[model samples]
Target: MALNIKIHKADNRGKADYGWLKARYSFSFANYFDPLRERFGVLRVLNDDIIDGGGGFDTHPHNNMEIITIPLKGALEHRDSMGNSSVIREGEIQYMSAGIGVQHSERNFSDSEPINLLQLWIFPKTKNTKPLYDQINLEGKRIQNSIQTIVSPEGGKDIIKINQDAWLSLLNSDAGLKHKYELHKPDNGLFVFVIEGETVIGANIARHRDSVEIKGVEEITLTINAPSKLLLIEVPED
Candidate 1:
């Protein structure tokens, strides 16, 4: 089948700054509304956020949403009503199944260093399930110069489980590197997020913070133009 691709440039994303925090929304979020960019398949929210030292989001509530947090730099202090509290830093991914409802708070753990992270919200396959929290440390487990699964459905090896059939993988490679990503489900679509550096997806170039939504193809090829970090999400299109 032929592939269909749509690119979302970094600068085109919605931006918000509040002194202590700076955020770029890939989809409609908070006050950054865009009718055309509301969502991509089951992927609801993707926010690139930077929090200054000692600054962070206050307690908030979420329900029926699969929340994933990827720390790019520094550390994030998390505390929830489930009596779970911990600090998640770079090289780590956190998952929170806010089934039914949950109240949580995330703050910068460092008093001097800023924290950069990606927050993703995926619609769950089922509603009113039990809330849960988990984190995965990717220190030595992640595959170098290739894509590695960070989040997947239960029964996957060494992966954080989510309440959906989606799969989330991380790719880190140097310039001139080439890789291929195969879809787990034929009806699913892939959302490629350029976390750092640049890459060529099909005929288009995606720079830092840019994203490419792809569908129809069974696999997609990526060419790294520079040392790059990417997040590939495969989720149900319908």
Candidate 2:
């Protein structure tokens, strides 16, 4: 089937600089509001943030949302009202289900080193359930030069689970490689974000922080121009 595609350029993202925190948002977030950039399917927020040493977010409240954190550099320390405390580094992924309601705080784990990370918020399939939190490290489990599933609604042995009908995957490919990604649901929407390197999706060349959103397709192809790291997200059209 033919697809409907939208490319979200890296330079077009909303940016914020607070000295200690530097953030680039893929959707409307914080004080950055864009009517045309509210959301894509059920995926709400995608924030690429860099936090200076000792910088952190004070305890904050959230309800009925699924939050995921992926550290790109340094260490991120997480603390929540649910009594969960942990430090996740570059190779780890953290998930929190802010169902019903919850409060949490995140910061650079090191007092002298800065942390760069990506945090995403996805609306749950069902609301008002109990809040939850979980995390995982992809250090030894990563499959080289392939698309590897990291998070999904149906959590598995090596995959983290969230309370949404969504799937998250990581793609690592070498230069001159081509990848074909098949969606789990026919009616679902696929969103691709480039974390490193450059790749061609459809007819567009997407580089660092660029994203392509696709709909009405069962599969899509990606041509990697160089060694690259990418994040793939699939969510229901609802």
Candidate 3:
């Protein structure tokens, strides 16, 4: 299998800044439209956001989307129309399935501390079912220097469920750690994003916020050039 790979540099992402929120978009979203980056496989939106203290989005509607949020720095207070409310902090991940339709808002949990988070929206395989919410703290569950599966199609004890045949994993690798990641589904593609530090794949290098999209291959190898935090997202090609 030929490994077709493309790198999306950190500086190339679309940027938008409001008074309270600063965001970087990996794909076309909101008013930032890029025909070439409208979507990647089943992955629709990947937003890296920094929210000022006490600021947040008001309730918004969504349907047929599987939304996942990972707090990177601080805590996020999430409330939805489904009567689910929770504060997801660093080391915690949240999932919201907007099956038919749902309204929700996410605000900084602290009034004085800014928050950094990554949010993703993926196209669901089955829609118009039931809206749901789930979250998990990975503080003690994470295995150092290993790929920890956080989200998958099946909602198990540790992993949150998405409405698609996709998977999301995280790796906290030490410098010099060598890793190999294999796709769960042969047809699925992998989106590898460096959350922190540096990573090298073959001749490719990715540092803070940089991402690589690889498809038409079953697996890939990576070397942690620095103590790195990485996010692995796998989804169908079509």
Q: State every prediction's TM-score relative to the real structure.
A: 0.97, 0.98, 0.98
Q: So what's the TM-score on candidate 2?
A: 0.98
- Cα deviation at 12, candidate 3, in Å, is 0.5
What residue runs in model 3 are displaced by over 4 Å at the alpha carbon? Answer: none
- C-alpha RMSD between model 1 and the true structure: 1.1
* Stretches of model 2 off by over 4 angstroms after superposition: none
Candidate number with the higher TM-score (1 or 3): 3
Per-residue C-alpha lDDT of model 1 across residues 1-238, encoded as one tens digit per residue: 5689999999999999999999999999989999999999999999999999999989999999999999999999999988899999999989999998999999999999999999999999999999999988888787889898888887356699999989999998989989999999999999999999999998999999999999998988999999999999999997
